[model samples]
Target: MTNSISLLAEEQVPESYGWLAGGIGAVIVIALLVFWVASLISIIRSGYSVGVKILLAMAAFAYPFLGPLIWFLFARHKEHKTRMDR
Candidate 1:
């Protein structure tokens, strides 16, 4: 009985930490929003053609997190490479 009671107490989260989790979640969400907006801006300002811009914007809007990440990791680098080749 004592062991069970101890386990239950350990499983219960302290109220003090509840707000910490929420704050961390909010920060993560805000950061993602900022990243998504920046990616969209980059796409619009890029030298890519209108069709490419539209496609990239659509991808960013569609996938939210993954799209922007992929754009930064792959498309952005590809654009830079092409520009350097010119």
Candidate 2:
């Protein structure tokens, strides 16, 4: 009974889905790389001082996904507000 159940479980899972999962994962990684690169470029081009630029770049490099997300959600808006006041 145990052998038959194990065989049935293995048969039920399709092997073809491996490629689909790999493709999806590759797309996600590429998107993250693009986003990270864009964030780095934005930081470099902003009006921030040299020290601030270094710190922001470091944060982005260290945290990868979370760092850019924080910058976009919080720091970017703050920078925009400061610019508007100027």
Candidate 3:
């Protein structure tokens, strides 16, 4: 009986950790979604042409992590250039 109880207790340990991991994953996904929306808004306000804005927004929306990378690499540089010009 004691052996059976010990086995049951060991099984519960992993299950608790599984729940913790799942909760952390949920938080990460929500945070990424919020960041994506903010990036999209910044793209809109970057003063690019309508066509360029649409392209960057679509790219960022389609790929959450990669989208921001592309925006920072290309679109954001353009924004900085425009600011310097002014």
TM-score: model 1 vs. ground truth: 0.77
How far off is residue 52 in model 3, in Å? Answer: 0.5
Best by TM-score: 1
User: Between candidates 1 and 3, which one is better according to TM-score?
Assistant: 1
Clashing pairs in 3: none
lDDT of each: 0.87, 0.83, 0.81
TM for every model, in the order presented, reads 0.77, 0.75, 0.69
* Residue 38, model 2, lDDT: 89
Estimate, for each residue in 27-78, the C-alpha lDDT of model 2 and write its tens digit.
9999999999989998888777788889999999999999898877778766
List, in order, the clash count of every candidate structure: 0, 0, 0
Per-model RMSD to reference: 6.6, 6.1, 7.3
Flag the better candidate by lDDT, 1 or 3: 1
